[model samples]
Target chain A: MEARTKAEVLRRLRSVAGHVEGIARMVEEDAYCIDIIRQIQAVQRALAKVNDLVLAQHLRACVTTAIRGEDPEERERVLEEIVEVFEAAQKI
Target chain B: MEARTKAEVLRRLRSVAGHVEGIARMVEEDAYCIDIIRQIQAVQRALAKVNDLVLAQHLRACVTTAIRGEDPEERERVLEEIVEVFEAAQKI
Candidate 1:
């Protein structure tokens, strides 16, 4: 991971963690149910963003290199991995 | 993605989605608060597992290939991406 990307992801995750804790507190305090669910959804979306950035970095660096390389095995492996990620994304 | 990995990830995600929905219902019924939080934590852990598998596939294919390739740029890029992932994992 690039240092910048690492820093960004960590920062976002930390914020998400705090958000989760806040939601938990809200629940404990008997806050509105729909509001709590909305917060959870927000955290999930934030996580999805982090996943997207990480996957993009993988594509730009690792996948591109494998596609450009001479070895058939490496190329096949990288392609399969990329397909897997896409499939997972569809599930999301 | 390899066919097997794709199938497994999809199946797991489907289950997790169901689990999440179940949690929502529990909340609606005003089920025990601690129990609901536990379920949420379980879903989060399940997601982390999916992320791990995707990351492992990246490492085995893209990162390994880049590290072995002749292009210094590719090598450096992959190494940095990996470091970033590790840093993010630590935040988790």
Candidate 2:
């Protein structure tokens, strides 16, 4: 990963960790369940943005490299990996 | 939340927070994007489980109470809140 993207991704993930902690606190305090669910939803959305950032970079750099390279096996592997990611993402 | 439910929710949330930090570490290490995305997906799924746990408790306890109680306004509020939660969850 590029240093900048790495930093941005790390930052967002750390914030996600904070949100998770917040949810735990809310649970411990017996805060409203609907409220906790809302927080969980927010964290999931945050993680999705992180996914998009990482996926965009992957497509721009690694995937592009494999596609433009002469190694058919590498290209095929990357292609399969992306398909699997998207399928799993749909489940998410 | 009930004692057991509270403990379980907190435990799962702590695990999710740990996973988020792990993903941050992976980003810092410049791990493969697909691998990081897989981790993120796992975290999201874990969060969903927590949501289910909390929602179940709410329905079994709080929602059940409101339905059986005479507070029409509280019942209406909970119903609206649940609708909003499902709407947001669909977006997730």
What's the DockQ for every one of the candidates? 0.02, 0.91
- Poorest lDDT segment (10 consecutive residues) of candidate 2 chain A: A2-11
Off by over 4 Å in 1: B1-92
- Pairs in clash, predicted candidate 1: A1-B80, A1-B81, A1-B82, A1-B83, A1-B84, A80-B1, A83-B1, A84-B1
List chain B TM-scores, each candidate.
Answer: 0.87, 0.96
lDDT of 1 by residue, A1-92 (tens): 55565566556655665665565455456553334434555666666666666666667767788889999999998787667655654554
Relative to the real complex, the DockQ score for model 2 comes to 0.91
Residues forming the 10-long window of minimal summed lDDT in candidate 2 chain B: B77-86
* Runs in model 2 lying further than 4 Å from the true structure: none
Per-residue lDDT tens digits for candidate 2, residues B1-92, read: 89998998899999899989988888888898999999999999999898898889999988989988999999998888888988988888
Q: Is the docking of candidate 1 incorrect, acceptable, medium or high quality?
A: incorrect
- lDDT score, candidate 2, position A28: 83
Residues B7-91, candidate 1, lDDT per residue (tens digit)?
5555655666567556546545655333443455566666666566556666776778788899999899878766765555555
Per-residue lDDT over A27-85 for candidate 2, one digit per residue giving the tens place of the 0 to 100 score: 88889899999999999999999999999999999999999999999999999999998
